[model samples]
Target: MRPVDEHVAHAVSLMAPVDLDEVALAEAFGRVLARTVTARYDSPRFDNSAMDGYAVRAAEVTVGTRMRVAADIPAGSGEPPALHSGTCARIMTGAPVPHGADAVIPVEHTDAATAEVTFYQSAVTGAHIRRAGEDARAGDAVVAAGQLLGAWQLSAAASAGHATVAVRRRPVVAVLATGDELVDPGMEPGPGQIVDSNSTLLSMLVTAVGGVPVVLPRCPDRPGAVAAALAGVDADLIVTAGGASVGAYDPVKADLAGHGVEFFAVAMQPGKPQGLGTVNGIPIACLPGNPVSVAVTFHVVVGPMLRALLGAVEPKVLAAPAAEGWKCPAGRAQFVPAVVESDGSVRPATGGGSRSHLVASLAAGRVLAVVPAEVEQVYAGDTVGIMTSILENMG
Candidate 1:
């Protein structure tokens, strides 16, 4: 049996970040940046008032002293008349500060008037003034290469004056689920048949990592049929569910054997059956039929490849303490669906055993607590590696 990391490394060696393309800022969400984004102009662009107030000099009227209003400056006004001695400019929020004005006095601090305004207190220089380049300067690097652009990053890029961004093209993943006993949802099954959920699960998983998922129809266990289904699929990666393990009615591994596919058992529980090969010059990753196995293998092996193909970084894991004690399998590494408590303690989310076929147990947790192969027994307060179920925790 091969280690999980070794299989992931081999998968990554066959692929890299897709070509770069310019996409509109609206469409660039969740895409990895292909180049550094520099600021086109300084933030605030010019000195402006941060509040709706009067722009005036420090030598202006003291407490209860009335000063003549020289000009009215609203936002987007090209320029304003310079501040004359003993005069102030009526300015609105976000409007440029008039020349010779050193500070802003809020409208509330001035008496309501048209021609003249009375200040309740002396003005301080540079108060409530948003200076040019205070937030970010022109030509400064705002967004770095290889960074995934999300809502915050997109907002920052927009603030930097970017209408579009160069980002890595998303890889297309073909998801095919196998098993003659599998039937689509909302259909009545006769005798021994189950609904096909792995296809949609894998497709959603593929899309979670920014890859475009192309889900194909379910393939039967026949070798010829599986071979025909595997042929001529246009995708960067082909992911197949079922027929990967050593079973009597499984032909996914045998059908692709001639195409350089190698099926093996991973040194991990739940997802022991794993396969990798190239079919029609496209890389195919075979995962087990069980829903839980599909999820575990996809996150451990396929998630890394997706990250590598998108020029993204590896997921970060936290060593959280366990809230309860449990014995683990002797030889294989175990991954149990668990939730972190408010106290940051990890506990099994499922009220059942850690069986691969227990599909419903997968949704009981937000993270997967990992127990190494050597850990035969765990005690309360013991630390275990954590893998979050959500995409936000991946990076």
Candidate 2:
């Protein structure tokens, strides 16, 4: 029996980041940057009008002074007549301010004509002009390595002339759901058979965490099939959702051992019987068959390992508050499904038996409330450990 944190640490340490690849800007979102992204050109590139206005020399706009309109500059048109002495140009939003124009008086403040314009107010130098490089300068660092790309970041990168981005490769994980009692959800099962939801549920979760999920053929209760599957699957990581316990049919442990897999298990309830090993140098996470058990173990134990394998700079645990009062048994860590409310509060969700493979509770839950082995009693608002699905709100 080992501590849960120790198990997590071991899994993370055993994994390494995948290689880097250059992907199109559209495909780079949610991937960690493998190299620093510097700006190729300054944003705004040149001084431009911030609104529909008259671009004129600041010196010409004395109190109530009027100037003639020389030309119109609409956005995206390359050229506009240069501003002459005592003259202005009709400039639209994002249009480059004409040369020799030092200020922009908004259209609301000026009346315009093809050859003349009336300024209702004085203008200050550099007014309403977005200077070049105001947002980002050429060669300036826009994004650093190891940073996760968001929509806004991608847009900025594109604007700065990055058509493709180098990001840490997403790990390919092969999923093998074991157990003879487990049956595909769409198929009819014999007596004592159960639907196989672990693979389906876990695959989505893995993709959500930025890991690739490969569903392999189900392995039977026999050790031979488990060993063959473990040996034959090709992936950076392998996840099996059953046959990790001490049952007679639990062949995952012995099969992985035959392949020289190395790892340990943690002492925790509902998820106590789990395994972590490596077959053919590929990390293997053998999870319990119970629905809630596998989900909790994935969140607490496997998620971090996946991130580490993907080269995430900081592998974070999803945490929130406990949903309800919890009493910890003598020795094992307890994981309970809980709803994380909008107000940053957490409350328990139903379905917690080890044998009951209830995925509905997991779908409704926003967090996984954790009760450590040292904790004997837990009450509401006690600041318990939490693993939140809303990664942004976890902070």
Candidate 3:
């Protein structure tokens, strides 16, 4: 079997960007942009007021200097009136500063009247004024392609005069769980039965990574039933949670071989039995059956592949420092569920290790403290890698 890292590297090599489509800017949240967005017009458009005040020439706003009131310009109003010599106009916030005015004396600093307003303070050139194009110039690329759109990106598009954006289409993934002893939640299980959780977990994981998940029913341990379940699913990525191991009843390994599936296996704890292949040119990642094993493999293998399919240019795992001591068993890398404290501390959750099947530990983790095979002990203050929480910033 390939080392865990090498297996992931091979899986990543097969990834490619999905096709693109234009979606309304309002509907673009959580989607990756397929094209660059440029500014249609200069931000601020023209010089405007930053405060409700009297717009006047900075040379004219001396103490006790009185200037004739020209015209009032409120925000969102029509064209402003030009300021005559020794004159000022009543300007509200965001109103365009009229020609011949280089400064704004706040209304609070001036006495109001039709004839003239008395200034209580001196004014400087360009005071309280927003310069045209200060935020962005016209035709400038504001948002680059491949950026995942969020509220800020949508607002930027709206500010740039774009009502919609071209984004990569979400990839479709199919999930199947194999085991005759497994049953769906709420089913009364016979003596050897267990609840089927891999399907649900895989579905949620696929959705979290921006893929559409189609969960196929559990494939029984029997060969015929397993083969039937593997067929008839249309998906870009197919995931099966069990039957990849060397066990006699493990049928997924043989089933995929019969259907000509490729790519399989790696050396990793609680998840050594895994598969990755293509069925009819669609990518398939067959994860392991153990719940914790399923979670780890999905995040390590399928998660990055899905993002790659959505056009993430430099797809790679982001690591964080390990805040506490962690021991790694030799020969296989380990992914430990950890809570990344606000102060950068990583605490392993109550469940001890991979065999614990502590799915709750997965929920409690904001990061994963990865321990390499060669490392016997990860000490406090050591910088290990962390996988960021997918639920932290949902749109």
Q: Kindly indicate the candidate among 2 and 3 with the higher TM-score.
A: 3
In model 3, pairs of residues that clash are 319-385, 319-386, 320-384, 320-385, 320-386, 321-384, 322-384
- The prediction achieving the highest TM-score against the true structure is 3
lDDT of 3 by residue, 187-227 (tens): 99999998988888888888877888998877878876766
TM-score of each: 0.86, 0.83, 0.88
lDDT digits (tens) for residues 173-263 of candidate 1: 9999999899988999879999998988898888778889999888998877778886788998989999987787888977875567888
After superposing candidate 1 on the true structure, give the runs of residues whose Cα lies further than 4 Å from its correct spot: 58-67, 108-115, 118-125, 318-327, 340-346, 371-383, 390-395
Reference-based lDDT, each prediction: 0.85, 0.79, 0.80
Judge candidate 3 at residue 233 and give its lDDT: 72
- Candidate 1: clashing pairs of residues: none
On a 0 to 1 TM-score scale, where does candidate 2 land against the true structure? 0.83
- Clashes (backbone N, CA, C under 3 Å), per candidate, total 0, 8, 7
Q: After superposition, how far is residue 46 of candidate 3 from its true place, in Å?
A: 1.9
- The TM-score of predicted model 1 comes to 0.86
| Over 4 Å off, model 2 | 27-31, 56-65, 79-85, 99-102, 109-115, 119-127, 148-150, 257-259, 262-270, 315-335, 351-357, 370-378, 384-386, 390-395
Displacement of the residue 174 alpha carbon in candidate 1, Å: 1.1
For model 1, state the Cα shift of residue 275 in Å: 1.3
